[model samples]
Structure formats: structure tokens, C-alpha cells
Target: MKKVIMGNHAVSYGVRASEAKVISAYPITPQTHIVELLSEMCANGEIDAKFIKVESEHSAMAACVGASAAGSRAFTATSSQGLLLMHEMLHWAVGARLPIVLANVNRAVGPPWSIWTDQNDSLSQRDVGWLQIYCESNQEVQDTIPQAFKIAEQLQMPVMIVMDAFFLSHTFEIVDIIEKEQVREFLPPYEPEIKIDTADQHSFGNLAGPDHYMELRYMIQEAMDRGLDVIKKVNKEFEEIFGRGYGLIEPYRCDDAETILVTSGTVSSTTRAVIDELRDEGVKVGSLKIRVFRPFPTEEVFEVLSKAKKVAVIDRNISFGAHGIFYQEIKSALYGRTDIPILGYIAGLGGRDVTPKVIREIADKAIGDEQPERYINWIGVKI
Candidate 1:
């Protein structure tokens, strides 16, 4: 059914459709509406699920880890410092190999106390082993939830569906909320072979000696290696049922283009408009929207980007002492294979507007440059 809803409610609708058994999350701004609506759904019997109200994000994730370990489909949501607070438990969920799905409203970390958009919080957890999928629209945000659970259960890893703070999280959009009956056709019941069962008890996440520890870690890598194919398969099945689909990387006009701009989350929407404007001007440029960040769709990215003479990465995130987070990933993805001039542009942090003009500037700079002056360029910094 189609409904005009805020992005947060879209997440709730997704979870409801997926039939998540245990919903645990603490209320944090921009992300609070998700759990708030889920609470009402549980109260109204709209969703037959256990809603665990916790004091903090830490407890929220811990509850999800416990619930998931007990063989229940668990879910949670958070933003910014809240996600940062769940850091250790995030690893616990991964180490325990529990398939818990989380939605993180991308926000800037604070000393100045900003509660607005940026990719810092989620990208900071890149090493924590959760499969991260960034969404460009409310529909994708809603759709990714079921897909996340499918991938998580298949690989026994946690999944995070990230949306931009206000742009995609608080902003209202017309979303085709997939009904439970239809969603079930795409994502059936999640039944894992291994889960915490006291009757058939076994230790989990125990201290592993060096003799056996490395292989356990290696297994995670193996599962992640197969995850690319798993994601593709899941997307194909989801599309077969829902008639809409997305790829690991959505390359727009990249074929036969000289310069390509790379982006993720809501930024991709504006970037596309810039791409269209440039195309009208006879500029041979394109845009690549990165949907999945983890398992880093290296091959797909390489195939599209390697053909271009130059690639520009637009990040709403920054990694201190280096370039943008996605910029670093793009560099690592194409390092030795191509000598193309890869440029990094940082814009739209802390809720700053990343308008079409800003994206146009980046594209113009990329298209007209003989060689980039530096690896990373700040788009609109006052200094």
C-alpha cells in the first residue's frame, strides 16, 4: 500500500512487514519515531511482537543481542551518540553471530552538540562486522529492512540500514509500504539452525585460544565474501515479488562517461539531478550510488569506475587524519588497478544543505581539472 510517511515510520513499517519478533530500541531524536510507531503497533496488536523499552541505546542493543541469540528475529534503531554507546554490544552481536537488524539515522558526532545529518556515526563502526546498506529514499529505507534481515540471517551477521538524519529520516515522502503478505512472499520466515538453546546448550563467544581463534575470524570473512552474491540473489527475489529492486551499486549513466561522481544515502538523489544537468550541457559525466558499504562491492565498483578517466567521491562523512570514509574505500577499491585521478569532496555535514549547485560545482571541478590539486576537497567550508 502507498502511504506518505516520514522515513522513520517507513522503517517501522518494514520491521512490521518482516514480522520481527523482538523489537528493542531506545528513543533518540530523528530515530525516535521508528520505535514510537512500533510501540503503538505492538500495543494495537497491529504487529504481534515483543517491544522491549530500554533505558539506553546500550541496553537496547544488548536486549536485541540476547533476543536474537535466543532464536528470535530481533531489531533495533538508534542515531549518533546512541549508536556510539552501543559500540561494544555491536561487537557482541557480531561475535555471537546473531542476526539482528538495526536502523541508524546518520548524524554528526558532537562536542558542539549537533543532532543533524552526516555519515560519521555509522561509518565509524565500519570494522564492527555489520553489513551496512545506505538508503536514498523512504521506499528504499523501508525495503532494505526485510532485505537486511534476509542477508543477516543468511550470513549470521547483524545488518544496519542507514538513512540520512533529517533528509531521509525525518523528511516525509510517499512510500510504497510493502504489505506483510507480499513481504512474506519475498522474505519468508527466518529459521536459523544455530541459536541459544538451553536444552541443547553450548557455549558461544567464549575465549578462543590463538590456536583456534583465527579460523573463527576467517569464517566471518568467508561469509562476507559470499555476501555479495547473497545480496544480489535477495535483491533479485525481492524484485521478483515487489517489482522494484536495487543493486549493490547503482551506476547511473556511467557507461560511456568520462567522469563519474560517487555518492550514498540521500545525497545520491541530488547528485542525480546534477548528473542530468551536466548531461544536458554535453558533459560526459555520470554518478554511482553506493548502496552497500560493507563487503565493499569492490568488483562492481571497479568495473564501473575503472572505465572512467576520472572518479569523484562525494562523502557526507569524514575520517580524521585521512580523506572521506567512502573516499578511502573508493581509493582502496581502485588503488593498483587504475591510475585514474580519483578526487574526494566533503559536503553536507551537520545538516548543511547539499544543493544542486554544490553538486554541480564538484562535477564542474572534476570535469574541468587537468589533475586534482589534492586528494580531498572541502566543498563549502568557510575557511
Candidate 2:
């Protein structure tokens, strides 16, 4: 059924459709509505689940960890500092291999205080063992919940569904809400091989000594290594059943392009429009939207980008001294394979609008420059 709803509610509907047994979250700006609707659904019996209201985001994630450890499909939502507070538990979820799904509305981390969109919050947790999927639209945000569950359960790893703060979270759009009945076939009841059971007890998150600790870490890395294929398989399965599929990376008009722009989240949509405008004027430029960020999609990214003459990555978040997060990843992906001039531009930080003019400027610079003198370029900064 089609319904006009904001992105937060879209996330709620996705969790509803997935039939998550335990929904636990602490309210945070931009992400509060996601749990608010889920709480309502639980109270009204629209969803047969336990909506655990917790004090802090830390406790919210801790509650999810406990529920998921007990072999239930678990979920939670948070943004910015809320996400930061849940950092310890996030690692717990990954280390325990609990398959909990979290919807993180991407908000800029605060010092002076801001509730706007940026990738810093989620990107900060990049090394943690969680499968991350960045959504471009409300429809994709809604659809990705069930897909995240399926992928998580299969891999026995937690998944984080990320979206731009207010851009996708507060903005309303028509989404073909996937009903629970429709998703049951795609995501079967999560039956883990091992879970907290009183009758058949098993140790979870137990201490591993030096002799076995390295192997346990090795197993986690192994799962992450296999993540790409599992994600692709699940995406294909979802497409076959639902008539829609979002790949790890989406390359638009890249077949015969000289320059390509890399982006993620809501920015991808705007970048696409810019690409079309540039194309109409006989400019050979394309854009690539990275949907699945974790597992990095190195091979797929390489294949699409190698043929291009220049590649520019527009990052909404920066890594302080290093460079843009996505820029670093893309450069790493194409490093030894191709020496194409891959430029990195940090734009739209702290929810600043990344308008078409800004994108055009980056594109023009990338195409016009014989060679980029600097790797990291900042856009729209005031001295």
C-alpha cells in the first residue's frame, strides 16, 4: 500500500513489516519519530512487539543487545550524540554477533550543538563490525529494514540503516509500504544456531583467552569478508520477490563518462540531477551512489570507476586531519588497480546545503584541472 509519510515513519513501517520482536530506542532529534511511531504501533497491537523505552541511547542499545541475545529480532533508532552514547553497546552487538538492526538518522556530531544532517556520526563507527547501508529515499529507507534483518541474520552480524538527518528523516514522500505479510517470505523467522536458552545453555560474549582470542577476531573478519556476497545474494532475492533491489553501489550514466562523482545518502539524488543538467550541455559526467558502505564493494567500485578519466568523491563528513571518509574508501578501492586522478571534496558538513552550483564547481574543477594539486578540497567554507 502507498502512503505519504516522513522518513522516520518510513523506518517505523519497515520495522513493523519485518515483525521485529523487540524495538528499543531512546528519542533523539530527527530520529525520535522513528521510535515514536513504532511505540504507537506496539501499543495499538499493529505490531506484536515489545517497545522498550530506555533512559539513554546506551541503555537503549543495551536493551536491544539483551533482547537479540535471547534469539529475537531486535531493532533501535538514534542520531548524533545518541549514536555516540551507544558506541560501547554497538561494539557489544557486533562482538556478540546478535543480528540487531539499528536505524541511524545521520546527524552532525555536536560541540556547539546542531541537529542537522551529516555522515560523521555513523562514519565514526566504521571500524566497528556492523553492516552499514545508506539510503537515498524514504522508499529505500523503508525497504532496507527487512533487507537489513535478512542480511544480518544470514551473516550473524548487526546492521545499521543510515539516512540523512532532516533531509530524509523529516521530509515526507510517497512510499510503497511493505506489509508484514509481504516480507515474511523474504525474511523468515530469525533462528540462530546459538542463543540465550535456559534449557540448552550456551555462553555468549564470554572471555576468550590469548590462545583463542585471535581466532574469534578472525571469524568476525571472515564474516565481514563474506558480507559482500551475502549482501548481493540477499539483494537479488529481495528484488525477485519485491520487484525492487538496491545494489551495493549504483552508478548512473557512467558507461561512457570521463568524470564520475561519488556520493552517498540524500546527496546522491541531488548529484544525479546535477549530472543530468551537465549531460544536457554535452558534459560526460556521471555519479555513483554507495548504498552499502560496509563491505566497501571494492571490486564493483573499481569496475565502474576504472574506465573514467577522473573521479571525484563528495563527502558530507570529514576525518579531521586525513580526508573525507568516502574519499579515502574510494581511493583505497582504486589504489593499486588504477592511477586515475581521484579528487576528494568535503562539502555539506553540519547540514550545509550541497546545491547544484557546488557540485558543478567540483565537477568543473575535476574536469578542468590537469592534475589535482591537493587531495582534500573544502567547499563553501567562510574565512
Question: Model 1, residue 1: what's the lDDT?
Answer: 72
Candidate number achieving the greatest lDDT relative to the actual structure: 2
Instruction: List where candidate 1 sits over 4 angstroms from the true fold.
Output: 373-375
lDDT of 2 at 147: 92
What does candidate 1's lDDT look like per residue over 28-49, in tens digits? 8889999999999999998989
Assess the local accuracy of residue 213 in candidate 1 as a C-alpha lDDT between 0 and 100: 84
| Model 1 lDDT, residue 32, Cα | 94
**lDDT tens string, model 2, 105-217?**
99999896999999999999999989999999999999999999999999899999999998999999999989999899899998987888998899886778999988888
Predicted structure 1, TM vs. truth? 0.98
Instruction: Estimate every model's Cα lDDT from 0 to 1.
Output: 0.92, 0.93
